[model samples]
Target: MMGVAAAVFALTVGAQAPAEGSDQKRRLIEQKIRLVDTLINSPAARGAAEGQEAGSRALIRQGTQAIDDARKALADSRYDDAARLADDALRAVSSASRRMSPGEGALPESAQRKNLQDLGDQVAMYRNSIEELSRDAQKGSAAKTLLGHVDGLAAESRQLADAGRVGEAGKRMAEAYKLAVEELSRLRAGQEVLLSLKFDTPADEYAYEKKRFASNEIMVDMMVAEGRAIGDKRHLVDGFVEEGRRLGVQADEHAAAGQHAEAVRLMEQASAQLIRALQSMGVPVF
Candidate 1:
């Protein structure tokens, strides 16, 4: 009688365990769904999505799909599937957040000044490229107008910085960048742009590329900060950033050893990794 009772108890426990586990998983899925829904409907998230060309719906497609699928799975009593779908939804929301930053506060004074300089350089480069193009191009008038606006923005940025308004200066530079980039895109439409800028030496080319890479790195950093790509992306972003930093350090060592060629190669490699990192973060930098 004792042996039979023990056997019955064990059988009953085994039968109950699966149901309990499934219940736990179902609760988890419901919790995750609630959290993800709250985040997806938050003001910041909506604003961030609207900032993109495709609007809010475009940014949340993956996440919404996951939510829908998770609901179906839950209804069907597929607790594991529901949990997995909820995770996917959470990641999608995180990725969207990291894309545009929604409208975060500006960086500190020093960072703003530095960002202004970098952004100014980017805008100037685009302006110069537009100006250097032949006047007979189809977009001649558009390019000229853009250059005028860019020059004005550059001057305004300088004035603002001189008055210790670095934050405003950064905004001006960002605007100038948008204008210049749009003009460049228009000018480059339906034609390949000629590489007109010539470097005096390999070192000069290397320096240019290094500056470009630094600018890209800064922009990505700022975006990450504003968007808070924390939950699932922290480790991945750190890994790529670390790889880029390591490569940069090695490049510096080579440069100090008088290997300009090798330094340039390493610098390019670092830039590539940084771009790769941005892509991994769903930044659409490519």
Candidate 2:
């Protein structure tokens, strides 16, 4: 009886040793995960994204996803999975944090000067376009005034560029360029200006997108029936159809999830892809 009891005690102790060791491992992994979370939300993670804002934001998104997975693994006591995921999260968040550091990666003086010059030229071109648009037959007083404002902005941008203030010049030129583009878009707000479309709600916009999508689909079908889609053109048109179909499905999924704005955006893109197919089939899109 004593020997049997002793054996049972030894087995119980061995089981407890592994459990305790696992608990310690779990704590350490959790600590690392918490630190990653904190780093992702810190000031450093919010700052650095000037020219590479999109890239920085994408890294942060990836890190966040990894962190979520790490937590899920930890919940299931998958220590190895939890650790690996936490490491991935740590790497992505660290990269994003570095990217967020303000003024850490300044371009050389020559590069800055070149960028400013390019931006200045774009601003000047946009100003010229606005000037030409103002001469159009149906332009209103409001349109002329908008054009005048853009011209003034372009002038200011040029002045800053001449003064050798690269950063200020770039910013002013970028603003002028954006305003000029908006003015042009507004003046040309019609069938081709998709972004200029107005809708009472995202749902209405989504519906319009669906109609546009269907129109494009029918156009492609007609092109096929007329034997327009042949040779390399057939292959190109098919690629567009596949991409449009994929995007349309994603749009529907977003719609089902109540993300109507995203759904509308995706549907619009899907329609645009199909329109490209029509254009490739010898039909003018715009």
Q: Could you give candidate 2's per-residue lDDT for residues 39-154 as a string of tens digits? A: 67654454433345777778878888998998998899887777777767766765564343211333334644654555555455555655666777787565688777877776
The CA lDDT at 129 in model 2 is 56
Cα lDDT of model 1 by residue, 1-286, tens digit: 4543432233223323465777666665675676568657755456555544344356578888998898998999877677677767766764564454312322345545666777776776777787875384677777787788889998998998899877677767766765665556666777776645678987786777677666666556564775645654655564465446446666766787888889989998888877766665655443
| Candidate 1 wrong stretches, greater than 4 Å | 1-115, 134-136, 199-202, 221-243, 273-286
Best prediction by lDDT? 1
- Which residue window of length 10 is worst by lDDT in model 2? 7-16
Q: Please list the residue runs of candidate 2 whose C-alpha ends up more than 4 Å from where it truly belongs after superposition.
A: 1-105, 191-286
Candidate 2 collision pairs? 48-100
Native-vs-model 1 lDDT?
0.65
Q: Measured by C-alpha RMSD in angstroms, how accurate is candidate 2? A: 22.3
Worst-scoring 10-residue span by lDDT in model 1 = 7-16
